[model samples]
Target: MIRRKGCSEKGRRSPIYRVAICEDEAPIREALLQMCRELLSQLAPEHQVEAFASARELAQALADGAPFDLLCLDILMEGQNGMEFAQKLREENERISILFITGSSQYLKDGYSVRPIQYLFKPVQREELEDALRTDLRLHHRPRTLTLRTGNKTTVLPIQDIRYLESQNHWVVVHMREGQQTFRSSLSEVERLLPPDQFCRSHNSYLVNMAWVAQTGRRELLLQDGSQVPVSRGYYESMQRQFVRFLNLK
Candidate 1:
């Protein structure tokens, strides 16, 4: 089990989150290595970090069965670009979390097929990198129980108990198997707390758990409890790809 600094006691300690960064530029590569070391020290003290000057080097490392939790890849390089390398990585290991570090936004739309966790514009910002780390942590770590407050009472709920979330005017409604509970938080806030592989934003106002999905069509998702949620057209393709990956279908 992997343990994160701010995680609850019930949360299991994660196995070392081994990471690899692939870049061709010496200065950029070294900078990323330094940032990774600093961030891991603060957020995941026991994590392991590795660096490669090119995708070929990283690919060789991966072929050796060296488990990597996250991959920070650059879009352009001397030989194979990040996209091509990512394709190979996906073919080899579908579960590894990928984040692209690129100078251009042109490749952003193309990253969805690979199901990248996030895209960081170089030079990466501290806040952006930290946010990406938080996302990665949730993906690798199990959900923890959280204490939430109602009008006059405090209730402890395991994060896994939440099946979906809906946004109201200013508050978010958490829907569990038992019933719906209102919480004073934004949808984005709730999103940040949930695991990326388990949860997805289906609509502007709704987020659904893939675990409870009974069926999914082009524009809707049917939950195990017989609830149907609409999937926004904007997120349709990305959601479909993720759903397939989640089901281990391809």
Candidate 2:
């Protein structure tokens, strides 16, 4: 499933994405595994891909606490089909991205029931499969963690959990879903470390996460947490544009 997790350690930057492939045919299964491994090596070098010859095997792995960021499943199999397995998996884990590889177009309607990312026909083309994998990566990828230095203690915060950043004189306050953490750093310095596309400079002293923003106006932004952040005139237009672009991506 879409394995999203918070920062667990210090100084670790790259996050590994785990992918799985399920196809009964030995040749097709091997081919799919190779394609996925090759593409992920270029896109995300720290990724992993596991191949299963049947849906039951994949299900057993999941039951054994195996985590997967994406699943490349073939629709038809020996006992349990891909669509049936996907439906069962979705009940427990809805975050995982599924890419269906089917032999016929008849399963197209049923595939949508589980909300798959894309469907590729039999004898899948490398280009089409690559495109589907790219989409899955985009949906699964998240911004890196932000290391905050607070006095003698250091705090590592996942960028995705941060709702906003506020500048209070020489100190910066990191507002997150859990709580707030104050650190000695300038707003500009913190801005430089954050991803430009995810964090927007709403005001001279405030940087807001577009993902947490619910509504935007000329002067203020309403966040999902019901907090209002001021939007400076200089950054209002840019904030609006960025928010729109972020929405389109979602």
lDDT per residue, candidate 2, 1-250, as tens digits?
0122322123232356688999999999999899888877655646789999999999999889776778889999989999999999989887778999999998899889899999999898997887777666656555466666555676778887899999999888889998998877788777755655577889999999898998999989999989999999999888887778667656
Tens-place lDDT digits, model 1, residues 1-250:
1112233223343445678999999999988888888887755545788999999998888778667778999998889999888987788576788999999998887788899989999888887887787677756644455566656777666666777889998798878888988877778766655556667888889888888888988788999989888989988888886777567521
Q: Name the best candidate (by lDDT).
A: 2
Candidate 1, position 133, lDDT:
77
Please give the range of 10 consecutive residues that has the lowest summed lDDT in model 1: 1-10
Compute each candidate's TM-score over C-alphas: 0.53, 0.57
Candidate 2 deviant stretches above 4 angstroms: 1-14, 144-250
lDDT against the true structure, per candidate, is 0.77, 0.81
Question: Candidate 1 regions off by >4 Å?
Answer: 1-14, 142-250
What TM-score does candidate 2 get on C-alpha atoms? 0.57
